[model samples]
Target: MRSIVIIGGGIAGAATALAAAKAGLSPVVFEAHPASGEDIGAFLTLAPNGFAALRELGVADAVAAAAFPMTELSVLARTGEVVASRPTSDSFTLRRAELCRVLQTEAIGRGIPLHHGKRLVTVREDEDGVTAEFADGESVRGDLLVGADGLRSAVRGLLDDSVVPRYAGQRVFYGHTAKAAPSEPGRMVMVRGSSVAFGYTVSPARETYWFGRTHGDELSPAEMAAPGWRDHLVELLRDDATPAAEIVAATAEPLLVTNTWDLPAVPRWRTGRVVLVGDAAHAASPATGQGASMAVEDAIVLAKALRDTANPLEVYERLRRPRAEANVAASARMTAGATDTVPRVGSARRPADGAVERMLAWDAVLED
Candidate 1:
């Protein structure tokens, strides 16, 4: 099997395509969108663990250089009084679209074929190989098939129909301020209230990124797409003492909203010649800020497993499932904790260790 077909053109698929090429296989990446993530995507945090994985992939330096590394992160109340603080090191923030663009560029630079507008519709696997049929009616055959598609994956359903994505309690609203927030390198702030939580950070580009998550019912499509959504968000957090409302008011960028979702332990991750990766296999809520990091790690580990073993799917699942599942649970707890958004009372002066460090301090290398 010298050929592999990867579904999805996001982080996981891009990374996988690059790794597959490096492993001396022909890898083709298919994306459902007409163009690469040009108009969509929010900000993402890359912890040290994510950086380490990028380093192994030989793109860490470039990425770190292009991103804003956070120097300190503090957990505070709506009034902005600190309850806990963590000195963040080796953690960076970048636009999700930029990250995907960089990874896609890097993959293209390495001579990988990435096709856009190919929506996967059906997946068929026989003893000989597997084929992925796309919406355009074109089908691609390969020795191995990897479903690195996002949460709602058609390929995933083919592997196990029982695996489905569920909505978490809250939704995320993200945007960039029209005027940049203060340029503070390595500065990260998260404030929680009893019902709503908000976070704001600056990218290396000096653009201010902010997200607000509130525990509430699903919004109607009209409300979600309304031109007043930004104002609606501002009003949602008006009582909170955080800068979220200010950020929302100042943002000229298009407001983006997403209903956060996650999956429980998948009944299975692989079947026959097909296997799942990234969110397709196990998606964690963004509450822990580990979703993207986990995706990157999955790409690297999956590549290594494919290169080293005869049963690469089994090896990949064995090594990745436990950690990925644990992270999913941690994310759930973090989200639940946000439910009680009452910012803690008093000033927390001393820097405290955060689970972020322990979670970020991971060994992602695939041992020989």
Candidate 2:
């Protein structure tokens, strides 16, 4: 009952492999991509809770070394007037590719075999264990199977065809520019423009990372990969007096665009020897910026559950559902423009008695 099979080599999969290894379980990763550096253009900020989880997995320092700090966040109105300014302690920003490479490298260093280009095709479970068949005609047997594939997960579809990712009513665009704005060394600026929610931060290397969300029709894959999103986004921000328009106009790199998607709830998270984690189980919109953070937290908790309990899947779902769903609901609210308050990353069921802190503590024993 020690061998574990992990599907998907994204952030969730790699992180989970590390967590499982740390918990004394034998785990291997199967990634659909040919390499670890897909989605290199996109970037995200990892909150403190994410770092807490990474610390538990013994990879925080490695991950942090590839990221730059984000010390403050400032919110602005459409008129470019400052609405709120607050410090965001212990937050770091880095490319999505860098994060994946760091985690995968760490997992390989720990002797966890990661097989790329192995796409999961089907799963068969017996009374003893589960066997996963890949598209490349390879198969592996393990005592437990974990699905960390992501929003459009093959495992989720196989588990229950009804569970699918839905659009969250907005199209998000991300871009980078060498042209500097009026940004501080470690401050992120968010502008609530007339038709777009925009945010930008300057990296230590003087590149500006910015993203904008606009209410619009869902884009086709061809449209998303097209080269005109920068001009379209600039036009959307033209009316606002904020720096969003100028920053976007200065971007020379191809702008990345995609429809925002989320799963408010997954009717079932597990069955027998199979369980889901990260976006595969509960994916939230990017409105709250907690997707990666919540995913890392999932890895830590799921590993702890496996380490401490007989019913690892049930125990892991029981401990994780509430917080993960809270993030989904909050992100939905923000994406729908249902709230006027500034979006917060961790507005979930975080108790004041240090419960979440304890949950991520590697030395702390988990009680089922």
Q: What range of 10 consecutive residues in model 2 has the weakest lDDT sum?
A: 338-347
Off by over 4 Å in 1: 38-41, 339-368
Encode model 2's per-residue lDDT on 7-70: one tens digit a residue.
9988999999998998999999999999888887889888878877887888889988999988
lDDT of 1 by residue, 9-117 (tens): 9988987886677666789999998897753558877876777667667777778766778888777677767787767666778888778888899999988999999
After aligning candidate 2 to the native by TM-score, how far in Å is the CA of 339 from where it should be? Answer: 9.6
* Candidate 1: RMSD to truth: 4.8
Best by lDDT: 2
Model 2 lDDT on a 0 to 1 scale: 0.87
- The TM-scores, one per candidate, come to 0.88, 0.97
Off by over 4 Å in 2: 338-341, 345-349
- For all candidates in order, the CA lDDT equals 0.75, 0.87
The most accurate candidate by TM-score is: 2
- Residue pairs clashing in model 2 are none
